[model samples]
Target chain A: MYNKIGPIFKKEFSSYFNSSIAYVFIVLFIFIPNLMFFYFFGGIFKEEMATMRRFFQMMPYVFIIFIPGLTMGSWAKEKNEGTIEMLFTFPISQWKVIAGKFFAAWALVGIAVGSTLFIPILTQLTMGDFDWGQIFTQYVGAMLMAATYIAITFFMSSLTMELIDSFLLSSSILLLLTLCGYITSAYVMIFPDWLGWLKVILNEISLSTHFNNFSKGVIHTKDVVYYLGLAMLFFYFNMKSLESRKWS
Target chain B: MISVKNLVKSYGHGKPAVKGVTFTIGKGEIVGLLGPNGAGKSTIMKIITGFLNPSEGEVLVDGLNTIDNPIEIKSKIGYLPEKSPMYQDMIVYEYLKFISEIRGISNEKADDAIQSMIKLVALEKVASKRISELSNGYKKRVGLASAMIHDPEILILDEPTAGLDPNQIIMFRKILRKLSEKKTIILSTHVLSEIEAMCEKVIIINNGEKVADNSIQELMKTYDKEQFIDFVVEGESLLSIEDEISQIKGAWKIEFEKKEGKNQFRFKALISEGSDFEKNLKSNSNNWKLVSSEIKKANLEEIFLKLTSQGEDNV
Candidate 1:
């Protein structure tokens, strides 16, 4: 076993913690979702039977904002700082470098997402109405949704050497992917024929479309395939862009 | 052993950065790649390191083509890029350790490699400090140390001493000199003296082409063979010797200046049979003694300028 991915993985993972912004990410990521669950969407105590539905509802919005911040620096900073020169010259394959950075960012986001485990457990402890299966699916859905976001941002980061440009481009795309599921239905009712095909396409492409069922206490094979497939597609796109950078 | 043949690299549709530049470096030979800014020196190094693909032609490292077998070629090379861009947050010692691991050196050997690199580049004092905290010179040493940690047989270092102080440059050259016995080195620099001191072979490139390729001794002897001869003669004034100086057949661009008590005259020489400028001067200036004369051959700095400036005019 070459274990080529281990050193890059270890270094990339520790680098996230080395900076103070990682703390900022965790605090805001955990705090904002809980805050919205408690205060903005009607308090947990205000409902007849409270659950983490609102928390799950806001997870996509939070990820659309934070995951770009995590991945914006992955390829963009390396390209800008010219570390890509040294890294690309190494004997290792380019995809492994992308994988190492992806796993590091995804795992860090996982920790921030994992801390929300206390959310479901607290609901179970305080109330007798929560479903363990729903909570599990929601956690699994959140993690998978994050994989797609991370993959998309990694692709965007590889397209440019400037960090700000990568952040802006990925952020705009992530926002569209998440919000399209909610907006496409309304647009279809107004314009039936042209907007009809959009519904079919967005159903397969939308981050919210697949995630909608998971939040409603159900998991399907199509949704799992949708997330993993999208994630893999974008990662492949990233590898292609890196190939162009080197070979072209 | 490395061989580059007819390498052509172009960005988009623009002019090729390297245009049919070909050279071969033998085993254990330290070759300096000298060029002006944007002269395709870095492009050649990048191609050799397997970081960039040549649009046409090929580079062979130990008989393996670069495009076909980049991984095997890369494994034998240790590269220090132009900027020496280390991860800013990584500690000096940690960076070397990372390189060792990626290079597939085991833990025990990696520790030994790290310690030796620290001592080699004199990075022991700041080994634990963050890379961003180190100064430019120290960062360069760290880059050099990291590149050599794998103990690769071929080294491709780009501007390795760009930011080092005088003392550090000497120390850097000393390290390279010691390593030259075992490693094949190809480095690029604008500082011609660095090449004169370190490399026996120098390749001067200009405008994406090889302008001159020869050793120091061969270059001095063959390149720009015309020499300048200076003669100090006892003379009252230029009027007395003007007629005799003009009759010199084998030289031109003659100029005279009065210094102390004698007149010193210099001319470019391309000596021919039976038409000697010194003989002419001596035959006419028998009235005034020829005090002393010296012939000055062109140095590396002059030859570099002559080669590259000529390149500047053509394209």
Candidate 2:
């Protein structure tokens, strides 16, 4: 099993570097976020807050779009090019291929996230006192959130043969999930006397609500489980999509 | 080396793509799977290669069932799909090396295997070029090289010569003939001459049913019983030739086509077993100008047409 997964992972991971798009994506992901943190209209300098709280707050929304673009061609390209037939006929299980692809995409996200270490270092250079613990917890949360988004994109990629469709589907799904938390928050403020328990359920399903826990420097066990569980759910669905081709 | 037993495959609610079709191919045999469009030739090859599952029944490669031991079965088979799909961005050598690694060739041997495959498939000229940069024939050679990189026991090629020039097709046939010396090959082609050139045995399927399966010679001999003689004659009225030929016993049918001159004609006579048409034609040489004559041997195309037409008539 290691023999099979190793080669698949190696090939998949290297394929990202074979094309110029991956480098362009990584550059944009790092460049845009850092540029926004430093020089947006009424940006970090105007906020007067030395912490990266605003950076963490807006990242989940940024990831909703970025992750889909990063993963749109994962399975969709393979299906469109008809290489999925070649992949399935190889001497490896379907799940291994999915796992290998997941790790390759996740590793790219890891590199993108890792490149943002400069932001924290710059924050430390300017501000004498910064909370390292909070930043560490926030990075952990951001990586977990990215995993969930990548998994959703992987699942979406498997559902169709076109890259644009996969991108649209995943972007819409992430948008709807993000909107759930905002809608439920507004609902609670307007009708406090009615259906208080419903707000709790909405927050339970909303990714932003869970990510908010990590940004606040409170590492809740339930929030950790929620992010991991969502990632697993999409991973399971992606495997199912790969397996369904035999019947389809 | 391969066995397909009562294979029945259907796409959702549609009719079965392959309906209870069964055949066994032995080692070192180049067998051609002949069929019209949508005749389940690709479907059967996919099932045998473990790319698609059969709705009912099973395929076995070297006694391992495809349903149960798919990866094991896949490891022994090399398949070039109908489209010859590939990663267009990858260089020819890199793509072959990738496939070699997937087949679990060790680091030391992978390079050797890939190099030999490039040489065998005649891909050295474009080895460093990206797959998208090559023409259709070169891309097909790359696909074939990748399929055989692992040195699989069985090679299943679906329309290996779909799009190629005449010279390329001839070169492909030569490669297939050489490959078949050591490997069992199952090829599907619409070009009947390709089958006649490369295949010793054939399994013809139509409408998801096995219409004919036998040695090429045996199938031709069985389905092509009538002997046809083409003769050129002058001073024979083309209109009265059929009447004159029908008068001879065992002369089943005759057709006449006008030649260049006014009185010259070309006649094809279908004769039965008891007909001594050669002697009779010479004896009646005075009646017409017997310019040149030769017996027409039945080919695979005629047998395929006869079997498929008979199948249509029955249906």
Candidate 3:
């Protein structure tokens, strides 16, 4: 299985380098939020503490767009180009192909997230008070969050034939997952005590709500399981979408 | 090497794309699947290649069931789908190299296989060029090379020459003929001449069902028992030819199909059972001139048209 999957993984991974899209995505992913955090009014770097709180705070929103852009064409492009049938008929199983493509995309995301390391490194050098443990957990949470987003986008990509449709659908779902908790929390504060239970449920379901635990250096078992569980759910759905495509 | 038993396939809950089609292709046989568009030719090929599962029945490749051992079956077969599925971003060499590796060719052997395939498909000139930069014919050659790179025992090609120039078609046919020596090849096309040029046995499908499956000579001989005569008479119309022609002893059926000219009528009818109505027609003509008389044996093209059209009329 590794013999077959290795080539698929290598091919898909290198395909990102064949064009400027991957580079452009990595550059944008690293710079855009940093630009917002360092240069925007009321930025985080203005403080002397060098905490990554504000950077981690903005990640959920940044990943809503970043992960979808990276994964929108994972399967949609294959279907659009009519290569999916060729890939499916190969000696390898569908799960292997799906896993290979997923890992390839995630590796690019890992690189993008890894590129931001200079930010924390520079913070430690200049301020000498960077929270090492919090920063490590934050990066872990970011990678997991990226995985969850990639899984959802990959699933969405398998469901549609158009790249734009996959991009829109996956980004929309990511947006809801990240922002709905905050929206419901604010509404719960405004409403009476009777609807406080609704807020609890929404917060429980919200991805950002659990992601915030890791961002704060709290390695809660439930939060880790929640993100990983959601990722697997979406991954399974992606496989199902591909399997159903044969009938379609 | 491939056997499909009562294969039936449907998309979702829609009408069956392939319905109760059964045929077996032996090793080293170059079989042509001739069909009209939407005739389930691609569906059958996909099922045999283990890309798509049949709704009912089963397909076996070299005695292994497609569903039970898809990877095993797939490993033994090289499939070229209807659309030449290619990665436009990758160079021709890179694409074939990827296929070779995925097919489990070792690193050392993969290079040799890729080199031979590139040479075999005449892709050496454009080896380094991206597939997007190549023309349609070259892309098809790339697809063909990818399919053959694995060097499997079976090859299932779905309309492999759908979009090739005359020269490219000739080159592809030569390649297929060379590859058929040890490989079981099932080629699908609507072009009767392609079947005639490449295939030893032909399987004709119409509207998702098998219409005819036999060797080319046997198919021709089966329908060759009856002959068609194109007889035209000038100077008067044979308005009552159906009535008068039937009395010519062995005349099977007569119908004046078209008006050839102002005073001429052309009739096409089957002459079966040792019918010799031509002499009777000439002897009975009052004023009309027997301008031309010709016998027409049903060729493969006519048979394909007849079977497919018959399929449509039934629907």
Name the best candidate (by DockQ).
3
Q: Write the per-residue lDDT of candidate 2 for residues A120-163, one digit (tens) a residue.
A: 78877986477889989999999989889888899999998999
- RMSD (Cα, Å) for all candidates, in order, is 6.2, 5.7, 4.7
TM-scores of chain B alone in all candidate structures, in the order given: 0.79, 0.79, 0.82
Tens digits of per-residue lDDT, candidate 3, B19-47, equal 99999999899999999998999999988
Q: Would you estimate the TM-scores of all the predictions?
A: 0.88, 0.87, 0.90
RMSD of 1: 6.2
**Poorly placed runs, candidate 3 (over 4 Å):** B229-293, B311-315
**Which sections of candidate 2 miss by over 4 Å?**
A41-43, A190-193, B226-297, B310-315
True contacts kept of each: 0.72, 0.77, 0.88
TM-score of chain A of 2: 0.93
Per-model DockQ against the true two-chain complex: 0.59, 0.59, 0.71
Docking class of 1: medium
Best by the lDDT measure: 3
Structure candidate 3, residue pairs in collision: none
Model 1 spans with C-alpha error above 4 angstroms: A186-188, B228-295, B311-315
Two-chain DockQ for model 3: 0.71
- Each model's lDDT comes to 0.84, 0.84, 0.85
Span of ten consecutive residues with least summed lDDT in model 1 chain A: A43-52
